[model samples]
Target: AQSVTQLDSHVSVSEGTPVLLRCNYSSSYSPSLFWYVQHPNKGLQLLLKYTSAATLVKGINGFEAEFKKSETSFHLTKPSAHMSDAAEYFCVVSLGSNDYKLSFGAGTTVTVRA
Candidate 1:
């Protein structure tokens, strides 16, 4: 069985500061890694994804993450934070290209202070 673990359950950042969210995962086979953001009272939006080609991936809103095989990690980061960026983030792992068998992390809540 595969699993995804988010190291931190919450992260707080002041507006205009940098942001970081950590994640780790284990899988029997090579897996697809993804980061998604859920705004308050809204649906989940795909942030970035790692599908084996490139280790570094860039997502919308100046978000980016690196897929590290040695550490089995995929950490998301942003150069600057905005108030709107305050949301819950999730790390996901999917095996063999099927969405149904995906495993989601507990979630990291980001709070941006003015």
Candidate 2:
């Protein structure tokens, strides 16, 4: 089984500044990692995923994450922050090929300052 832990419960970023959401994971075997963002009253949206293909994975809205096996971290980052980026982000992990069975982190709330 795999588990995820979001290092920070909340993160505040000024508009146009860099945004970083820290996350760490532990898995018995090679695991698949993902980052999902959910806005207020909206469904969860896929940000990026790493499945042993590439160390650095890029996603929508200029968001990206790097899978570090030695560090056991999959941190999400964006070059610049936007007001629309304010939301809750979750770190997800799956052990096998079945994506349905996933383990999600508590989540990190992002607040964008104007």
- lDDT tens digits, residues 23-103, model 2? 999999879999999999999999999989999999999999999999999999999999999999999998675556889
What total of clashing residue pairs does each candidate reach? 0, 0
Q: How close is candidate 2 to the true structure, as a TM-score?
A: 0.96
* lDDT tens digits by residue: candidate 1, 1-114: 778999999999999999999999998877899999999999999999998989999999999999998999999999999999999999999856555578899999999999
TM-score of each: 0.94, 0.96
The 10-residue segment with the lowest total lDDT in model 1 = 94-103
Clashes of 1: 0
TM-score of 1: 0.94
lDDT of 2 at 72: 96
Deviation in Å, model 2, residue 97 alpha carbon: 6.2
Q: Which candidate is the best by TM-score?
A: 2
